[model samples]
Target: MLKGEKLGAAIEAARIKKGISKAEMARHFGVKPPSVQGWVKYGRISKDMLPRVIRYFANEVGADHWGIEPGDPYAPDNLVQLRPKLSAAEGMVVIDRLSVQAGMGAGKLAEHFPDVIDNLRVSKDWLRRNATFTSMKNLGLVTGLGDSMEPTFSDGDALLVDRGVRDVKVDAVYVLSLNDELYIKRVQRRPDGAWLMISDNPSYEPYVIENGDRDHFQVEGRVVFAWNGRKL
Candidate 1:
């Protein structure tokens, strides 16, 4: 069955071929524009809504486009399984790995807008037991750069970032952008309604953003997990 990015690509291709706008599709499905974007971007949809999605597309672009037998819209074998078996192990989820890197030293400019470079498959049970996230689709992987976050996470570490966190909800490590540059640093809200961007290494001085200068700072996401690549 077509799943993951493949499924997303298929849906996008059919939508484009049919000349259907995302807003129009959302209205047809009784969902918001972002929900349709999620289906096209992450290839995920609720199981209960799968049948409707299949039928809608099948009718719009014809069943031949999706390799479904004619007149058998509900055929089990032709169904597009949203949660496909990612690995040999069952109950696994795929998290997109972004091509962009988050610098832990002096900030770096993103050469290009971030794109999905690959997918990281992890056990659902492990994710539920370890990570505190609202949804699996919001999680992404990025490689860390520089030694500013050493001892906690060295350079070249792989980090799990929650893209859904666009603001500093609590004092924690976050992937943020300052003056158009990207950085991974610990963020703390100051008592005076400002933000303190701190590096773990003492050599680098903390930077503070006052309320007036808040326009230059933007929280990209929250860093939840780090996989250190240090050798023993």
Candidate 2:
């Protein structure tokens, strides 16, 4: 029962599976970049653009295709509907944890680190929260809050961060914030007391944070893993 936009998302995933970029696809179709984005966003490439897309990704269509489901062939709800929001109390805690790690949340605290919990260390247990924290030993989670990290991270996806903390290395992706809005972007420290926040998805522009704004910005933590309701 897939229709309209869901169908378009399936095609987009198929395109990713094939290692093609949207800008490249737009060029292939002799169309504008936004035109291709519209196709991905709405799940419908215009009729004039369909032939070009079909020609480019010809081998991807299912053969003697079986009937499809009502949502995305993969991660259906993410593609087809808005996700349910966590309760304000729950969201507040998650946001608080992120703020704590990144060195700023919403309120001031005399003692930022907690002495109350023995399980709070950044270990397999901290991430897994289970009898056996084996599967998630190397994983961590962070909340995304703004569009500077768009295309790579949406407004609410709980990012799966990894254990690589400490210094900000070149080309390493970090979950950080400036002026209280958190972001996940590739970081490359400059010799001049500034840093570049590079967006992995090329559709967005890259920007830098100056030394003057450094106090308002800090590396909350590095992202080694990501998870959302639709992705793990």
Local distance difference test, each candidate? 0.74, 0.49
Most TM-score-accurate candidate? 1
Q: Model 2: residues >4 Å from true position, as ranges?
A: 1-139, 145-150, 162-166, 191-193, 228-232
lDDT tens digits, residue span 1-232, model 1: 3566676777888788768899998887778999989888878877666555654444235444444453554444434332231332568876766666889997888633454444567889988877777587789889889999887888888898888899887999998887678999998998899999899999889999799988878888888888653321
Candidate 2 whole-model C-alpha lDDT, 0 to 1: 0.49
Worst 10 residues of 2 by lDDT: 111-120
Candidate 2 C-alpha error for residue 64, in Å: 56
Put down candidate 2 lDDT per residue, 113-209, tens digits, no spaces: 2111101123333344421211333334445555545555566556655534544764567766555545567788888968887876676577787
Tell me how far candidate 1 lies from the true structure as C-alpha RMSD in angstroms. 10.7
Checking candidate 2 for backbone clashes, the offending pairs are 102-220, 160-225, 160-226, 161-224, 161-225, 162-224
